[model samples]
Target: MNATAQPLVRFRGVGKSYDGVTPVVEGLDLDIQEGEFLSLLGPSGSGKTTCLMMLAGFESPSKGEIWLGDTLLNTTPPHKRNIGMVFQNYALFPHMSVAENVAYPLTVRRVDRAAKAEAVKRALDMVRMNEFADRLPKSLSGGQQQRIALARALVFNPRLVLMDEPLGALDKRLREHMQIELKDLHRTLGLTFVYVTHDQSEALTMSDRVAVFDNGRIQQIDRVDSLYETPSNGVVANFVGDNNVFVGRLISVQDGRAEVGLPDGERIFGQMVGAARVGDTVRACVRPERMTLCTRSGFDGGTPSLNTMHARTAGTLYFGDHVRVRFAVNQQEGGFVKVPLDDESLTEWSAGDELMLKFDERHLRIFA
Candidate 1:
C-alpha cells in the first residue's frame, strides 16, 4: 500500500473490555486503506472478531476512537453506520426467498419497488446466484446459502464490508472455491473489506495485508509476503508458518549481521531482528525449505557466506509436492530439511547417512 493512501477505517488507541477489567483489544492502532482487502488473522480468543465487531459499530470501544473516513463511529448505531456485514452462520432469514433476503437492506431504507428489484438483480448476478433467487435459505446447499448471504451484503452497495469467517460453514473444496470467488468479487466491487479468520492459509490467499493478533494485540501487520518471509517477532514467525528455531547466545554484532554461539560451541551468522547485545540469549530461526542437503565434499568450495552443519538423516516423510527429511544435528533432534519431489536428493539419501546441511546467511533470522 502507498504511504500516502487515505485510510478508509482507522482504529486509534482503541481498547475494548467486557467488565472493564481486562482488555480484549488493547490499544489497537491500525489503518485500513480504501478498496483493500485486509484480514485480521489469529487463533480463537485472539480478539480478531472483537476488532471487526467494533468497526461495524456492533460493539463500542472502551477507550479512544474508531473512525470511518472523517466520521466518528463510537456513538453511531450499527444500522446507521452504512457498513455491510456477513457472519459465519449465513444469517439469512429462512422465511424469505433469496431475492427478498437480498432486498431486505433496501427495504429497511424505504427504496422504491423498481429500484430495489434492480439492485437485488444486480447483486445476485454478481454472485452468480440470479438463477436461485426464488429458493429459500433451507432449500439451498451450504455454498449456495453463502452466496446469498454475500449478495445480501452487497445489495445495498455499501462502501465497506465486514466479514467474520463467512466461509467457515462449507466443506474444504467449497471453501477454497469461495475464497477465489470472494477475491474476484472484491476486485470487481472495489470496496474496502475487513475480514476476520483463524485459518492462516485463508488469510494468505485473500488478503492484501494481514494483521496477526495474539493476547489481544497485533503482533505484526504487513503484506502477506513480508509476514511469511520476514516476521517481526518469534510469535509472528511461528504463527504464520513452519519454522525451525535454535536457541543461542549472542556473541557479536557488526554491520547488519550478528554471530550467535550455539550450545554445541559452534557460531553462526544471521541477520539480526531486534535489539541484542553480547551475552544476551537469542534464537536463530530458519525455514525448513531454506536448508539444503549436500555431501561434505560438495560444500567445501560452496558460497563463502553459506553456513554448514553436520547432520545424519534419521527419517523421511513424503508429501506429494515435497519430501520432509528429519535429521539430527549436534546430537539434537527436531531438525529437518525439505526437498522438492523432483530433486534427485530424495532418492540418494538413506537413514543414518551423514551429510552437510547448508543454508545461506541471509535466510537465517536472529530474534532476541
Candidate 2:
C-alpha cells in the first residue's frame, strides 16, 4: 500500500430520514481509500442506494456528516461534489450520439472545445466504444449504451465515481462481461468507485471491499473472500451465498470449538465464528462445495476440521457441471451438498442411500 492511499471519502455517524422518522440510513461509519473500489451491497430498501444518493448530494442526511478528504459536503450541491455518477438506466440523451453523450458533462463545466473533444475521444476509447461514437444511443445495443454511460461518467476525470446498479439492465452474460471490463477499468483509472448493487455475485466479482447492509444498517464490511469464509452473523452468511444452516444449541466450548446439540441427540463440533456461548441458541453455516458424500470407510481424516452429521441421501439434482445432493438428518430440515459431476464418491450413491454427510470443520460457521 502507498502512503497516498489515504481515505478519499468518509462517512461519520451518517444517517438519513424522510420525515424525521424512520431513517433510511442509520449511523453509517465508513472510510473509502483514495482509489479503492468499495461497494454498498444489499437487497432493495437496505439503504445501499440511499447511502450512494447522499454521497452524490442528491439527498440530505438527517444527522451526522459526510466528508470528502478534509472538506465537509453536507451543504455541497451535486455538481459541486465533483463526483461522476452512472445510473441503472444509462440516462443517456436519446438524440445524442456516443461522442456527444460522453462530452455532455465536460460541456456543462465549460471545458474548452478542443479539450472536450480530446477527453470525449479518450473516454470512448477507454470503454471500447470509439467505433460507435457517431451512433445514437437508440441505435446501439444494450451493452453499447451502457458503455456510453460509463464513458460519460469518466470523461470528466472525477476523483470519485458512484455507480448504482449500472449493469442491471443488461443480460446475465453481458453483465458478467461488463463486470470484468469495469474491474479492469477501475484498476487502470485508479479512481475511487462507490458501487451500489443488490446482486451479491456482482459485488463479490468487482469490489475490493464490500459493505453488506440490511435494515438500514451495515451488517459487515470486508474483503470478498473473508466475508464468505467468516461472516459476521447469520443474516450476512445466508445473504451472500448458498448456505446450509443447522439450528442447534451450544453444549460446550473449548479450544476454540463449540459442541452443539441439534434437535436430535446427535452432537456435532463446529468452529465458533460468530457470537456463540454454551447453552445459547445458534445457527451453523456450511458451504455446499465443502461437503462431500461419505459412504466408504476409506475416508478417515480427509474432511475439514468443523461440523459433521449423519445424513441419508434423499435426492439429487444434476446441473450440468455439478450435482446437488439433498439429504435428511435426524428428522431435522436438511440441506444440499454441491459437488463436481465426475467425483468418484457419487459412483455408488443413489437416492435413499444411507451415508455420512462430510464437511470441513473449519468451514462451519456458528451465528447466534
Best by TM-score: 1
Cα displacement (angstroms), candidate 2, residue 253, comes to 2.0
Clashing pairs in 2: 304-360, 304-361, 305-361, 306-361, 306-362
On residues 1-368, what C-alpha lDDT tens digit does candidate 1 reach at each position? 45487788889999999999989999899999999999999999999999999988888999989889899999999988889999999899999999999999999999999999999999999999999999889999999998898889988989799999999989999999999999999988889888999999999999999999998999999999999999998888888977878888999999969998888887788999979889999988899999888876666656768887777888899988889998877734467898888898678788888888888989899998
Which ranges of candidate 2 are over 4 A from the true structure? 1-5, 296-306
Clashes of each: 0, 5
lDDT of each: 0.90, 0.87
| TM-score of candidate 2 to 2 decimals | 0.95
Off by over 4 Å in 1: 1-3, 331-333
Q: How much lDDT does candidate 1 score?
A: 0.90
The TM-score of predicted model 1 comes to 0.95
Record all residue pairs in model 1 with backbone atoms less than 3 Å apart, i.e. clashing: none
